[model samples]
Target: MSEQDFLRRLPEAGHSLRRRDRLQHRLHLDFTLLLLLALVAGYGLIVLYSANGQSMDGVQRQGIYFALAFAVMFVTAQVPPHLLRRLAPWAYAAGVALLVLVLVLGIGAKGAQRWLGIAGFRFQPSEVMKLAIPIMIAAYLGRRLMPPSLKHIVVSLALVLLPTVLIMLQPDLGTSLLVASSGLVVLFFAGLSWRYLLVAGVVIVASVWPLWQFVMHDYQKQRVLTLLDPEKDSLGSGWNIIQSKTAIGSGGYSGKGWLEGTQSQLDFLPEGHTDFIIAVLGEEFGFLGVMVLLALYCLIIARGLLIALRAQDSFSRLLAASITFTLFVYVFVNAGMVAGMLPVVGVPLPLVSQGGTAIVTLMAGFGLLMSIATERRRVSR
Candidate 1:
C-alpha cells in the first residue's frame, strides 16, 4: 500500500502490543498452558456428550463447570507466590479443620462420609487437601535448607499423615492415596535422601498385610481380589472392569465411530460419564483418541515442569513440581484402573471425567503454576 496508510495504523498496532504485554506481565497468564488446557477441556466435552448417553444436558452442565473452573484459575494466577507462601499454612489448617468436620458433621452417600454440606450444597473436603498438603509442605520445607534434616523430615511426614489419616477414616481410599501422594511429592522435590525413600518403601511393603487385614474395608479388599482375577466373579465385582476392557478393546485402532460403541451406548458399561469416561473415549475415538489426549497432558505437564525449573524460590519450585507430578499420578491411576492393570479406585480421568470438584482443583493447581511461571519476570522488575 502506501506510506500514509502504514503510518496511520502504527499507533493502533502499538496499543494492541501494549495490551498483550499487560496481560502477560501484569496478569501473569501463561498463554501456551491456557491454550493446551482449553483444547483438553473442549475434547473432554465432546467425549462427555457421548459418554453421558448423547445428552446435551450433561454437556451443558460440564460447560458451566469448565467456565467456572477457568474463572477460578484466572483469579488464582493473579495471586503472588510470596503471598501464597505466607498463606499456605493457614490454608492447610483450614483444610484439615474442614476434613475433621467432614468426619463429624459430613453427609454420607454411597457408603463414604467424605462430603460436607452447607446450605444444601455439598463438597468433598478431601479435594481441598490435595492442594493444601503440597502447599503446606512446600512452604515448610522451602524455609529450611535443601536436603532437609531428619527433624524437618519427621515434621513434614507428620503434616502429610495428619490429613491423610483423616481422609482414610472417611473410607475413601482413592482420595487418601492422592492426598498422601501430593504431600510426598513435595518431600521428594525437597532433596530428601534416597535412604529415607528406601526405608519408607520397605516400611510400606511390610505394612501391607496389616493394611489389608485391619485397615481395608470389605469392598476395598474385594477390589484387590477382583483386580487379580476378574473372572472370579464375572457378573458381580468384576463386571465394571470386564465391561470397560470390552469397550476399550472393541474400539480397535480408529474407534467404532463416536457414540457408536455398543458397550457404552447400550449401557453395558456403568458410570460411563464419570470415572470410566476414558473407556468411552477409547470405545468411540479408538486408541488414537486416547493417545492424542495423553499427548496434550504431556505438553501441559512439560510446561509445568519448565515453570518449576525457572521458579524464583524453593516454595514455587517444590509446589509447582508437586502439583504437576500429582496430575501425572491422577492420569496414570485412572487409565490403569480402567485398563484392568490396577484396582478400581474411583480416580477420575483428569479433565476427561465429568466432575466439578476435581476439575476446579486441577485447574487451580495449574493456576499456581502460572503464577510461578511469571514469578521471575515480576522479580526482575
Candidate 2:
C-alpha cells in the first residue's frame, strides 16, 4: 500500500473509534440499574403529586428534587471509589459535627429538633449521619484485619451509639434506627456470625421493655400500643394506623387507580404525602403495583450488594453494603407501618416521601453506590 493510501484511511479509523466510544458509554450504564431508579422515582412522583395535588409548589419542589438527585448521581459516578475512601472520614466528622449543632441549636418540626436552619433553608444533620456513618465504618473496617476484633466491634458500636443517642435525644427514633441499621450492615457484611446476630436481636427485644418504661415519652408509648391495637384508638392516636391499613386493603387487587385514592384526595389519611406515602401507592396501584415497586426496590438493593461484593477494597465493599441496608430499612419499615405490623414512627417511603432532606440523603447514598458501580469490578482489575 502507498503512504498516501494509508493516510487517507486514518480518518475512517478515527471515526470508527469515536463510534466505539459512544457505544461503550451506553453499554456501561447497566440498564437494570436505570430501570430500577426510573420506576421508583416515577411512581414516587406520581404518589407525591396525588398526596399534594392542592399545592403546585410541592409538586415543583419534588420535580426539582428528582432532577437534583439524578445530577448528584451522575457526579458521584465520575468519582473513583478509592477517592471516596479518602473522603469518608472528613465526611463522617462533618456529619457528626452537624448532628451536634442540631442538638445545640436546631429547628423543630412536629415536636422534634432535627433540622438546622441554613441560609433560610432547613437541613437535617441526622440525614448526614445516615450517609456518613456507613462510609466511615467502611473506611475504618476496610483498613483492619478481616473479621474485626472485639475492640473493633465495640468501637463500631460506639460509632453507631454516639449518633443514635444524639438523634434519640432529638427524639427522632426513625432516623436513629435507620442510621444504626446502616452501620450494622457494614459489620454484618464484614462477616458477622449468625450467633452474634441472634444475640443482637435478643438484646434489642429485651431492651425494648426498659426503653419503653424508662426512656419513651408518653406519646411514644402510645405509638407502640397503637401498633398492637390500632382499632382501640381509632379516633385518636390509632387513627393514622387505621386509615393506613384501610388504604392498603382498599387498594385490593388493582387499587382505586392514580389520583383516585379516596383516602388521600379526600384527606381521610393523615400525612398521606409524607410518612403515609406508601398507603397512597398501595391504595391507588393495588397489589400488582406494590409488587412491582417492591421488585424495583429489590433490584436496587441487590445491585447495591453486588457493587459491594465487586468492590476493590474492604471499605468500599462495606460502604456499598451499608447503602443497600439503608435503602432496605426505608422499604421495610414503611411497608411494615402501612401493613399495620409496626408502629407508625414517621418513616417515609424513600423517593416517595415529600421531605427535601430525606430525599436528598437517600439520593446521596445512591450516589455512593454509583461511585462503587462505576469503578472497575475487582481489586485485581
Candidate 3:
C-alpha cells in the first residue's frame, strides 16, 4: 500500500530540491547573511524612531532607504565576481575623475565642499572612492603575485593617495581617512610584508607632526585640542562631546528607557540621529542594546570573512576582506568619537546611523560579499 506512494513522493521531493537550488543559483544570495543584515536594519529603525523624537517621518524615510539598499544588494549579488574584477579599474578611474570634479565645482555646505550636484541631486564623490579604491587595488594585485613587490606596493600606494589627497582638500577629513583605509586594507589582504607595514607605521607616526602643522586645517587641529581637554570650552567647540559623554554615562547599564533620555529629549545631545546616534542608543536602550547591535555586526563580519576565505580567486578574497574590515573601521571610529576616545570625526554608526548614501554604499558592499560567497558554488557547479 505504501511502496507506490513513497516512490511518487520521492520524485516530488527531488523536484523541490532542484527548484531551490536553481533559485539560489539565479539569485546568488547568501540567505544567512541577508537575514542578519535585515535584523540589524530593523533594529536600527526602532532606535531611529526614538532618536528622532518618536517621529514616524524619519523612520519611514530610513525604511525606504533600507528597502532600496536591500534591492541594490540583491542586484549586485547577481553580478559575477569576474565581472566586478573587469569593472574595477573603470570604476576607480571614474571615482577619481569625480573627486577632481568635486574640487573644481563642488557644492559647499557647513564650510566643506564635498558634494557634486546635478539636476537637483547632490552626492559625495568620496563615498564612491570607499568601494572603488579597494576594488581597483584588488583587481590590480590579484593579477600579480601574492606578497606584492616594492614596485606594486608603490603603485598601490599611489593609487590610494591620489584620491585621498583630493578628498582631504575638500576638507572632509573623516571620508578621506576612510577612503585611504579601504585601499590599504586591500594591500594588507594581499600579503604585504611585515617590514613594509612596520616602516609605513613609523612613517605615519613621523608624519603626524607635519600633517598637523601643514596639512591639517585650523578646525581639524582644534578638534584634536578639544579632544584633549573638552572642559576648557564646554560651552563652545566642546559642547557636542561633553553632551555625548553625559548622555552615555547617565544611561548606566540599562538605559533611560526608549525615548525617555533627558539628554536627547531635552535636546542637549546634538546630532543624536546622525553621527552621534550611538549616544541615543546608549541613553535610550542602554548598554545592552549597544552590545546586541555589536553582536549582529560581529556575525555579519564573520560571515564576510568566511566568504573571503572560501573565495577561489585572489580578487574575491582581497575585495571581500577589505569590505569587511572597512566596515569595522567605520564602527570603531564612530563609537570612539562619540565616547570621546577619539577626536570627533563624522563617521556614522554602520547600519544604525540615519543617512542615505552610507546605507546604500554599505549594502552594496554586502552585495559584493554575497557575490564572492556564492562564486565557489557557481564554479563547482
Among residues 3 or more apart in sequence or in different chains, the pairs in candidate 3 whose N, CA or C atoms overlap within 3 Å are none
**Tens digit of lDDT per residue, candidate 2, span 259-351?**
898998899999898888888888999998889889889989899888788877788788888888888899999999878898877788888
Candidate 2's C-alpha lDDT? 0.83
| Strongest candidate by TM-score | 1
Q: Write the per-residue lDDT of candidate 3 for residues 1-381, one digit (tens) a residue.
A: 599999999999999988876777678988889899999998998888888988999999998889989999998998899999999989999999999999899999999999988899788889988999999999999999999999999999999999999999998999999999999999998998899999999999999999999999999999999999999999999999999999988888899898898988888988998999999888887889889999999998899899899998999999999999998999889999999999998999988889888899999999989999889878987
Report lDDT (CA) for all predictions: 0.93, 0.83, 0.92
Model 2 lowest lDDT segment of ten: 22-31
In model 2, the clashing pairs are: none
TM-score of each: 0.95, 0.90, 0.94
Question: How many clashing pairs does model 3 include?
Answer: 0
Question: What is the TM-score (0 to 1) of candidate 1?
Answer: 0.95
Candidates ranked by TM-score: 1, 3, 2
**Which residue ranges in model 2 land beyond 4 Å of their true spot?**
1-31, 377-381
- Name the best candidate (by lDDT): 1
Expressed as tens digits, the lDDT of each residue in 1-381 for candidate 1 is 799999989999999988886778788899899999999999999999999998999999999889999999999998999999999989999999999999999999999898988788778889999999999999999999999999999999999999999999998999999999999999999997999999999999999999999999999999999999999999999999999999999999999998899999999999999999999999999999999999999998999899999999899999999999998999999999999999999999988889888899989988888999988888888
Cα lDDT for residue 167, model 3? Answer: 94
